[model samples]
Structures are given as structure tokens and as C-alpha cells.
Target: MTTSTTRQPIHTSPINLTFLGTASAQPSSTRNHSALTLRLGSDAWLFDCGEATQHQIQKSAVKMGRIEKIFITHTHGDHIFGLLPLMAACLNGAGGTVDGADDPRTQVNLNDSPMEIYGPLGTRAYIRNGLIYTHTLLGRPYVVHELRFPGDPQDGDFTHLPPHRSESPNGRNIPLKTDLNDTGTWRNIYSDNVLSVSAAPILHSVPCVGYVVNEASVPGKIDPTKYIPDIKRTKTPMSVMRRLQEGEDVELSDGTVLSGPPRRPGRKIVVLGDTYDPSPVASLAQGADLLVHEATNAHLPGIDPATKETDTYESVQERAISRGHSTPQMAGKFATLIDAKKLILNHFSARYPGDDDVNEEARKIMEGIRDMASFEYDGPVLCARDLMSEDVVLQQDNR
Candidate 1:
């Protein structure tokens, strides 16, 4: 099912995936580069910040001010060019100005909480250079956490890169850290009270990684009317209801004990970077509710010679492998392997005429895989477009 790309309605589901931009390598008339936002409760976690991502957010329902964390896949320009601008916009109160003025004298404090950024090695350098050249400073400093796989290049080991020429010597530089963990292990990168984020290295041209966002399981709804008819007739105290909602057994004055409903498993959403092979994401994305994978190209019938706009020298599969990208078929197989309930194909090539073409091709490939393996995966294969939003509904299954 597809919907308009204007705004996503408020949903009861705990997690939501909003595709800010879905183009690959470059922007097109209808599609932007790679960028998406995972809205968990009131806060937002951005996956990538490709070119014009801030503009895309402005067009969608996602609030830039709520983006507390950003995860970059690689250093490619298409994937990260818009990051600094977005940061600047966030610092400017999402209006591109501080205190409603562009003048530095009227700059107002913004971003009360420090924004955390996660990416592979060289992320620090990239952000440092962008901030330096742009002359952008935040009222509340941000932090950059660099994620690296085993044996990756190690640069200068400062905990955090200091600000470039501090104007208000009082303004603190954002803390930085190099989180180097064993390769192929899903290491906990960040966590809060409501959600936990983990990352694992994926097959990309650069030191890229995939991230999984796991929301904390919540206790199912408890109805006092069903458990205790006397309490419902007399109206139980709010405190007693709160205790039951907190998953604690409560006893009323009548000496009758009431137990809360069982706690259901939380939802899992996986966002994969550009990868030619999907094997790396298998273990990390097992049984995910939503899998956002890149589909750079489809297995088109004929190869048109290289034009000024398109690459000419290699076949679709050859180009995908050599450039560390994935085809639609590869993405479908990966989703099948991971048992993702729903698949959202993103980062489409500009060559595709429309979303229907991309969705059809991917579905055909997925169907082929199911037939070959004698298994069935009937989940939706959505072709993501800029500003498209999907609500991730958690399954109640015990599996």
C-alpha cells in the first residue's frame, strides 16, 4: 500500500520510519539522495543525511529539532553532504536563523541536549572540516561517536574533536569517541531508557555499518473491569491502575490480587547501508519488523551505452558488485534471509522511470526466491520515495 508523501498521520505504533530521501548517488526530479528518519516516541533518529535532507524534512512531518541522534553509513557525498547544513538548521531552531535573526549578535541558545552522531572512521574529520568551513557553532555542543571495525585505520585519538577557533571560550567542544569493536559482532553503540541501538559492519565500499533500533518491550494493556469487577463498579484509585500498568501485581482492599498482562516483545527496525552482499545483515536483522535496504539498480534487460548521465562500462550486476551496491533482487533475498516482516526498498537509481517499476521488479525477484527455496514471504515490498512514512506495528507473536 502506498500513500501520498505529504505527511504521516499520528500513529499508535511506537516506532515510525519516514523516508526523507530515496535516490542513489545523485538527486532526481522526484527523488532525493539517501536519508531517512526513524521516529521513536517523540524523539527522532536519523539514519543518513544526504544532500538536501534538511529541505526534505521541511517538506515532511518529521521535526528537525527532535533528531537526537544521526547515523551515517559511509563518507560518500551523496550520503553525508547535507549533514552540516542540517545541524546548522537544527541549531537555528529549524528556521535557519537564531532568535529569528541571522546576525551572530542575536544568536540564541538551541538544542538543549547534546546531539549524538555515529558513523564509521573518518566521520570526525568530515564533520570537523564541515563545521570549520561553514563557521557554524551550536549553543549546546554536540558529540560525535566514531564507530570502527577491527583493523580499520586509526587516526588521532582525541576523545572529541575540539571546536575550530572557539569564539566564546566558554562554549565547549562536542565530545568525540572512537568505538572500535571486534568485526562482525553486533555491539551496543548507544542506548537510552526507551530504545537501544546496535551496529555491525556491512559490505560497502568504505567502512560502512548497519544499525538496529530496538524499542523496549512494554507491558500489555490491563483492564481493571475484566480483572476486578468490584473495583470497576466502585472506581479504583489512579495509583492502583498505575501500579498494574507498571507490570506489578496489585492487591485491592478486598484482598483480591490482580496481575498485569504479559509484556510483549518490542519492535526492531534495521537500516542497511549500500552493500553488494546482504550476508552481513542477516544476523543483525533477524525477524525485524521493517528492513530498509538499498536497491540501486534492477536487472534490466538491455544495457544502454554509457551516457553523460549513466555509467557505460559494466553490466548491472558487475557495477553493483564493483561499486559495493545492491540490486533489487539482492535486497529481496536479504529480506527473505532475515525474515523481515516488511521490506522497504530505498536508494533507487535514477534510471527507473517510476516507483511502480522498482516495486514490480523487486517483487518478482522476491517471488522467484520464494519459489526456489519452497518458502513464502508475503510481506509488503514498498518502493520508498522521498517523504514517504511507514508505521512499524509490533507483532504479538511469541516468536
Candidate 2:
């Protein structure tokens, strides 16, 4: 049976990932640009809104309106070409209903809450200029928050034109705190009740950042059997049970104190954009349940297949580093260094087609990349494909 990316009613998993696009600098026949979405409870957070991302979302199960927050690793065209179009669609009430299905979650009503966008320097100018030149007027408002690092572009210099008569204008772009912590991590780029996102500077040709999504720990399960007998014997109010589950010690009339166990730790998901060395974010991504790293190019040990040249691991690594990208082995090494439990390789080169099932050569190439990564990181590694969905199940907290 074919799986679906549609949100299920009963499954309230904290972090669910859907890979919208997995191509690198260029897109291929089967792959679009780089894009992905994480469904955190009711709201969806999008990362790297690449070209044709909206079309990819339409084909997937992710709804449009649920994408409340968008995080851009950089202002590369392949990473953010879809931003303006997506915002326009949100305002025009287009691209909401998939296959003519009427779902309110996919629609953005008039004067709906603004979409918050977080990105590296030059993001504000990109969004502001795109909207202005395109003559686009989103009925709904949106806000862009730029993250500036030292030596990066100066902030608060971009000016927005006065709103057109029919335009839904929003406030000026807000620049986040650029100060880095002791560990060099930008703490709490965004935080809410469900989860928090952090970022760190990464090595790239242009200024780039990687993000870490940490789900909030939840209360541990309460054993009703242990407390039911005490409740009946002491005639204690059942409200005390609620308090106990909330990690509070409650004393009954008979002086019986009930203490809940420690809270269960949530899952950690690390997602990085194109980078040669992503170690800057390693401190924040340690022991991640899922590490989504880029493997843009890999060595295929053969002569005269496509490039008519012999390939070696060292040669490929050197080329990838020069281009500000990562090979499968490099991605694996980083995952192993960070102690990631599972690794999903993404942002593949266009040379390797994404539709592995139909192309035997592509399938072998992808498998070869996975094997190369496994050589460094002794963990499960998956090559991401367009429209692929991953359900991240948090491990049981034995401690």
C-alpha cells in the first residue's frame, strides 16, 4: 500500500518530516530544488523554500496554511526562489485546496496572522525587492526576520515602499539578536510550547546557517494502578492526580506525598543546508534523533561513465569542498561526530536522478552513496527523495 503524507487525526507525533525537494544547485527530471517541511503538532514549519516548492506541496499531503514559519538557510536562488510565489498564493487563496479538496487548514482567510520568516543576511532585501518588482500584493501580511552575523551585510538599511491601495502591508522586517553563545550556537531562534529552533554559522561560499529543532520534553506517563489504591484509601480528590502528573508533589490528608517521575526527553532533528563543514552546529545537534545533511556529490569509482574520468573519494571530497558542498562521506563523518542516531542524506546532485525505482543506474548510485556514508557513520542512512515523508519516533527515556 502506498503511504500518504496527509496528516492523520490520531497521530500527534511532535516532529514529522516531509521532503518536498532534494536536488542540489540544479533540479533534474525527477527532483525539484531543496525544500522540506516539519509538522510540529498542528502547525507546519517549512525549511528552504526552493523553486517549485508550492507545486511539491500540492502533490504532497502538507497543507498550505499550516506553514506558519519558514526558515531559510541562505538566500541562494535554488533555496528561496519559491518564497514570493508561495506568499502570493497564500494571500490570493490559490494553491490551498489540493485536488479540489476543500480544507480550511489549506486556506488563508482575510487578515490572517502574518507568516514569520527567518533567514540569513540579504533575506530582507530579497523578499522586499521580489514583491515590489513582481507587482505582487498578498492579501495577507508576512514578516521577514533576518539573522545577521559579524562581517555579514549591514541590517536595517532596506526600505519598503508605501503600501499600494489594495496591498496588505506588514511591518518592517525585524532583525534577530546576532550575538552567539559560548558554544557558538544562536539560542532560540524561535521557541513556542511545542518546540524550539536554534541555528549556527556553517561553512559555505555565501553566508549560511544550519538549524536544530528540539522538541519540548513532555510529562512522563503516570501509573494509575499505583495511585488508584491510595486515592480510595485516603479519599483524596482526583484533582491531585493531575498535579502529580505535572511533576508536582501533592500531599494528601493522610500525609501521603505523591511524586511524579522525571519528564521524558523529546526528539532532536538537525537539518543543514549546503555546507562543506557543518561542525559549527555540532554542539547544538549532538545525539540528534534525525540528521538531515547534504550529500551533493559522491565518488563513483569508474572510468568514462558520464564525465569520462576516473573517480576517487579524495578527488570528490576536494571538489565538494571547493564548491562549498558535502560528499556522502563528509556528511556521514559529521553525523558520526555529532552522534546522530539516524542520518538522512539530502540535496543530491542532479546527475543522480531521484526516481530510483524506475532507473536501475540511479538506484545503484544512490545505494553507493548510502554505503559510502555508512563507512564513516555506523548508523542507518537514508537517501532522501522528493515527496518522501519520515515519521520521527522519539526513543523511550529509560532514565
lDDT of 1 by residue, 113-195 (tens): 46777787777668777676555655555666676556755445332656432222222221223345433655556655556
Give the best candidate by lDDT: 2
**Against the unseen true structure, what C-alpha lDDT does each candidate score?**
0.69, 0.79
Q: In model 2, which regions exceed 4 Å deviation?
A: 1-14, 93-112, 159-183, 237-240, 302-304
Estimate the overall C-alpha local distance difference test score of candidate 1. Answer: 0.69
lDDT for each residue of candidate 2 in 195-237, tens digit (9 for 90 to 100): 7788888999898989998877767778878787888899987
TM-score of each: 0.76, 0.86
Which residue pairs collide in model 2, if any?
Answer: none
